[model samples]
Target: MSAILSPRPLIKENDVKATLLSPDFLRVSQPKTFRHSIDVYLKDSNATGNIYFARHFEWQGICRERWFFECVSADMLQSLGVFITKEAQQKYVSETFAFQKIDCEVNTFGVKHCSFSLLFRFFVGGELVAVGHQQIVFANKEKKIARLPDHILAKIREYEVEKGE
Candidate 1:
């Protein structure tokens, strides 16, 4: 398949805000393949409501061979951090899967776009485990990002399963 016809643009970076408002669709990345994909939605932090992002994984092949992945830009991370308190972080760590560490990189995706690459590390106990990455592009550099993409919602689902399930 040609790159132009690929499903890459199914979700545009600019649509990050609207997608979170009400996302009825759940797009899953191909399962068990070396190439994986995810979508996450972010809800309003100041609002009095609860919106969660979830993903369902289809496991296959060798036990240790298959792993899931996800990523978020630094801008998204900071915006989320405001709402993700220490307590929330603790709860996230305890209730969800292991969060080993997050590695970040910033660069221009193309001549027309600036992007942030986040490498997420998943783990069990003190040992290292799965890994995922996200590439966020700032298509419109002039626009300010108060909210972020929904692709993270799907990533959170897998995050809850970083450890054996």
Candidate 2:
């Protein structure tokens, strides 16, 4: 039997930060139309206390520096399903299949109209593709749940959030 190969490593911390600092990552644009809807739940379990918002459907899988917080919930993590795999994340950071956006807004509280990006690296038909400079935002006070179909949650559960010391 053949063994599986691992995805490429994430971009170097220095390089990633450098990329973020460049003028290329600084420009953001407001979309002409809304894309996706992300539901938010407050820590109090009452939706009324906090505001939550998601990118209009048009923004997903597009930006490089993607982030989700505030209304961040296990359900939100679960919604990503298999798409949140380690390999997928590696692919994302490595710019394999790049997703990027500009001037995005998530207006609830803390995270008002923040700029974001995401990068990816992946293999297709045994060939490599690197997608770079992707970004997105989730309004604070509002939580976003990625909403995945059943069966996919199994893989989603393996994902974890990292905190800085």
Candidate 3:
């Protein structure tokens, strides 16, 4: 298949910008996350019996939310306003069917005062099915950007796990 019709090759280049699809992106050396298990349901599938392309992005957002909830309290989260997805990149490694229990592992990257990046790897049966990445920034309902709260930043540091560990 041609590159246009198939998943594009992710080249490891010197000038390639960091995105979820980058070769430098994170994934656990081991297959199992042993955390939350996300179910792949019919709602997540397309007419062709495969997961819709956009569902990967949705699952990415879900995983991000789950991680944030772990990092802060519900009341504090409400005060934090919306977390704008500044950028996203995804690569579908293979097809995953409905009814599979997906294991997702979240990794933190590029942590800054107002923004950070997350890499989510989706796996089934110890095989990678997809990888999604997002660059997230703090913003209010008005979309006004703000510096990341110290509490959140501190948790993100504690949240990250070394890939090979």
Give Cα-based local distance difference scores for all models: 0.29, 0.30, 0.74
Count of backbone clashes, every candidate in sequence: 10, 45, 0
What order do you get sorting by TM-score, best first?
Answer: 3, 1, 2
Candidate 1 Cα errors over 4 Å, as ranges: 1-113, 141-165
Model 2 ranges with Cα > 4 A deviation: 1-73, 77-116, 141-165
Q: What C-alpha lDDT, on a 0 to 100 scale, does residue 163 get in candidate 2?
A: 15
Q: Per-residue lDDT for 156 in model 2?
A: 21
Residues 1-165 of candidate 2: C-alpha lDDT, one tens digit per residue: 997776865677889999999987987642221122223224312234422112222233432113232222334443333222112222221221212212332211111123222333233333443222223333323343243333432222222111110
TM-scores for every predicted model: 0.22, 0.20, 0.69
lDDT of 3 by residue, 1-165 (tens): 654554655576544556665655765443223245788889989786687888888888777777766654545455657778889999999998888888887877677888887878888999988877788888865778888778777776655544333
Cα deviation of 53, candidate 3, in Å: 1.7
Candidate 3: where is the Cα deviation over 4 Å? 1-34, 140-142, 161-165
Candidate 2 at residue 12, lDDT? Answer: 78
lDDT of 2: 0.30
Instruction: Give the root-mean-square deviation of each candidate in angstroms.
Output: 20.2, 20.8, 17.0
* lDDT for model 1: 0.29
How much is 99 displaced in model 2, in angstroms?
22
